[model samples]
Target: MQGINRCPPVKIFVGLLFAFALNVMVFTQIYGQEAVDSNIISYTDKLAYGVDLSTDIDEFIVSGPDTENFHLVTNNDVKLTLRLNYKFLNLSFGFSPGFLSGNDDDELKGDSSFTEYQVNMFPGRFVQNVFFRRMKGFYVENTEDFVPLWQEGTDPYLQFPDLKSIEWGGYTGFVLNEKFSLRSLLNRQEWQLTSSGSFIPALRYNFTKLANTFESGSYGKENQVDLRADLGYYYNYVVSPKVNIAPYARAGIGPKTSKYTLDGVVDKNTYFVSDYGGGLQLGYNTDQLYMGIRGSFNGYTYKDESDNTISNNLWHGLFYIGYRFETPEKLKNLF
Candidate 1:
């Protein structure tokens, strides 16, 4: 009884500590800047209009003692995403809407049930300087999913639930030379999913010049290309997610977050799990807009408390297209 009573206080204390730390960091950055440059180049000065469309298809097969009777269950999913971005005062704001759906079926019978998922995200960013940049951002995501279950001699049914996730983070980047840069991001994500929270810390190296040099100075000519690689850890409730299978095909890694289970028991020991993958990035950027696509392949093994292990693999893709408009101040200069 006493232990239960103590939980609330601990949570409150931690929450307050985090808030204080965030406030301190923000203030320090704001005050540390020497002064606002009158000659600063803002994103509004390079405004371009664009649009992006993307779709992904993934298939997974799960088999084991528990799933053997079901005889090779296969899951297929597809997602479509769209986004828009605008710049003002050297800041950028982006909004993305996505639709996803999938089906699970018996490999032999091919008769299966379907599930649906949807998500929308709005992320806003503030950039301190255009040449050397420090960025801070906040994002909120809303998601909905429908899960279907089937019982023998009974009709298959669906369960629909809506979920929300929020993240606030900042990235600081240093241009090491002209073509290379180092970047780091710290983000906190809270999900309505299972009442879970995750903290992600990532470090990336940017190869910005290699891809940009190849394009011509046309309307859609690419001004910058980033060949980025990152290593990060996901700290989640009761478990830490690991990146095990590193895919090495593209210029950058794709979504680094996933779930892995072994046997029937959830494996909390990092060494006992293999859950890692990498991705590829291809995109074009103009003065006003940036568009890109990322694709990744991931594999992991998970165990239940019952000592059963399940292996899963996923191939996912993301397409981002957006337009950036000039700020009012920059518009004034154009006229």
Candidate 2:
């Protein structure tokens, strides 16, 4: 409870929402009337709401010249999300229901919980995302590699019940092509009638901390600050006026500064890390209804002070269905 309590509270999340609202107001005031090719792009004044089902899993791997790989993982459970969009504003809330939280064999894999708050804003050709994530508990995925003659179905894996991780980060980027409609594909606020592609370049940053509840002298804690620049390409193939398929890929290299505390001793080091990912989305859109499915994977790798290489990877898939309706008079008045 103490470890989880160290995370930012609800008030901080509310502050993020306030900041996002300000961005939407300022950006819409400046670009609301900007004209575009209507034949190629179209907008809907209706309000939209949706339900999304998703699964996200993280894997951490550590290896050294004289050591075999050690894999750590958290339970990959289903998350249910409710999303709402009005004009340029979007909001979402997500949670895992007990029934969907998969079997909890805590003795073998330990218990885990994940909490995150994220916001995405689009102002013209610019894209921005800000988020915070906190995760607790993990278990070794490759138990047989360390525990000799371990039975797969009967033996328990090594669990890190006291481990905790927290991250604060975001990304800002620009879309290159004026003919492309990123909003059409991502937010469902605009619909594209023609197939097009764009080159996007983004800057990403993160402040991360990893720690355990064990006493000093052990793997006490590690803090990392990193910044990277990525270039990605996205293309939407308009299979029909109401359907599209999109594929995108990106890669980045960055500088990472890490501080470590072990046995009450502290050490600091810097390294260059590399990141890469790609994803695909298929969607069907109409004036009053929309649905889609998407899958993506991303990862980063770096070498530590002891020459041990550590890598983190995340893979997720999502299915969403949404409805659009006329904006109520009161909602329109607010805008």
Candidate 3:
């Protein structure tokens, strides 16, 4: 990679603070401007604000140029995301702190002991994990086989000091008939459905980026970028005046790119990705306040056929509670 600059943990936290403050300011401004006519209607009640705490389980793999050898990598990420909505517009931003846990990790030291064993102690390290070893934040430690793989005066080992990364992302979307959090409650008043279901379609997009692993002598970096668009439908069934149960299904495709560096050589590739799944949503919605919980399971895989031999399949589970401000259609704007 050209350089190694770790994204401090503060970035995500600061971003969250900024997003929340901006939403608060927006709410105040909208409310302040409503003095023009308390009885006259100028704008629809089209605003929502909320936050979500989520966990993402990410899995990865490494193989040779021809995709011969295979190794499994995984990460557990926890995030705090903030969301805002106005009319058909939707926006969300989130942050995930740095954490590392994999093969040869030292639980006591909270670092990668793999670095010392592969780079410092092992003598014949050049023959093992050749591709994964040269990654930005990874190092080689000698296992003390006592014989150097290369000739005398040759040192193939490097130290990266640390091997951890932080991740952050944002999302934007358009809802045709309904939205999350706010829509569930509004639909109750608009349609006056006593019991039954209705269909709502949504268009969604999201992008995620993470810092590279290694510190120096890197060609490129190891990180991911994914952009997806999906048009999905949900059926909302009202169980009670205060509760609604919904079953949702969606299928979408996108491009997922990953970058890796070895010996100052960069291998960056973008693979066609596809995802499909369904889930259930339960919420308590009203004109002034709304609260809800949702759960979903999804499956994703790369379009590259070469990975078929290996288990490149990935899946995720989501559970989050959402709370948002709601305004009565009769009262007008939510300020």
The best candidate in terms of lDDT: 2
lDDT per residue, candidate 1, 1-335, as tens digits? 01111123234434533553454457456655222223212242334443334333322233456543111222223333332223221222222222223332222122222222111111212212111111111111110112235343343322111111112222322222211101101100111111122222333321111011111321111112222233333221211121111123212242222222222233232213444555654444444445556666765555544455644455667565555564467566643
lDDT of 1: 0.29
Model with the higher lDDT, candidate 1 or 3: 3
lDDT of each: 0.29, 0.82, 0.42
The TM-scores, one per candidate, come to 0.36, 0.91, 0.48
Which ten residues in a row are the worst by lDDT in model 1?
A: 180-189
Q: Candidate 3's residue-wise lDDT over 51-94, tens digit each?
A: 66555443343444454333333222344555554432334544
- The number of clashing residue pairs in each candidate reads 21, 1, 19
lDDT score for residue 115 of model 3: 10
lDDT of 2 by residue, 185-274 (tens): 777778778889999999999999988866343557889999999999999899999999999999999999999887679999999999
RMSD of 1: 19.0
Candidate number achieving the greatest TM-score relative to the actual structure: 2
